[model samples]
Target: MSKDFYTQFILPYAGIIIKICRAYTDSEEDFQDYYQEVCLQLWKSRENFKGDSKWSTWVYRISLNVSLSLLKKDKKVNKKSVELPNLDAGAPQDPNPFNDESLKLLYLAIKELSELDRAIILLYLEENSYQEIAEIMGLSPNNIGVKITRIKKKLKTLLDGKIY
Candidate 1:
């Protein structure tokens, strides 16, 4: 991919990277650091990107790979607890942004989900088509659709406090 292609096509999706990082990290700093790492890894892998896939699909592949690899490293280093250093010990928590408390709760519930579920949720939440999500995740489009359906129900239940 050319630099302009990266900037134009890939940069606008940076929020998705932030969401992925936040899903993987418990603390804000670690989230930022991991997001930066994902950006670097994505840039490094630019040449490996082929035109067979959408840019978003390519980014999803790269970001998920980096996040999962980092998660594995984290597991190896901190087997019991994944606590990050406390940088904002006294900072007040910010209110969730979505007007729909359910949506906000959904994002909170997403953080509790496994890494695989997080990727599914991230793409679905971004309004990616089932085919695009399937392409990025290497799942059949039908399977991706079903999983997304199940996950959405799971999110609603969690948001409604039907299940913790």
Candidate 2:
């Protein structure tokens, strides 16, 4: 990717990509791999973008799909311990709601969700409307609503330590 494109297009949206990656990855190494692969795939698939949706939405779809694919491959190859790194290492210390300790716990809880539910909750947290999430995930808006409700309950249970 050209510097101009990287600066103008990818960098502006890198945070969203990173958040999606972090949601799916257990370790910083895996997160870096997913982030790089997502950037490469974004460039490779740029031609397929037909202005049907906002560019960020397209990026979100690609990032989520790439992370889930890598995760599935990892699971098939290694059924033992996944060996996730310390979650705090290398994480930005910036004082944002998403970076706070409670939110970090929320992310750890999110990581326990099934891949599709992880993607859905990440999109919802990003403030995407249910219609937009449905469009991205190829599900009906009503289905997205129902899934969001269930996912929220799941997250609550996970955070409350009610679920093993």
Give the best candidate by lDDT: 2
Candidate 1: segments with Cα more than 4 A from true spot = 1-10, 79-103, 161-164
RMSD (CA, angstroms), candidate 1: 5.1
* lDDT of all predictions: 0.72, 0.82
Q: Model 2 reaches what TM-score against the true structure?
A: 0.87
lDDT of 1 by residue, 1-164 (tens): 46685577556876676566666777656666677777788788777887898776777787788888988897888843345424343222233333555554566688777788889988888889888888889899999989988888877767675334
The superposed Cα distance between candidate 2 and the true structure at residue 144, in angstroms, equals 0.3
- Model 2 per-residue lDDT tens digits across residues 1-164: 88787777788888788888888877768877788898899998989999999999899999988988988898899833455535454433223535456777888798889989999999999899999999999999999999999999989988886333
- What's the lDDT for candidate 1? 0.72
Residue pairs with backbone overlap in model 2: none
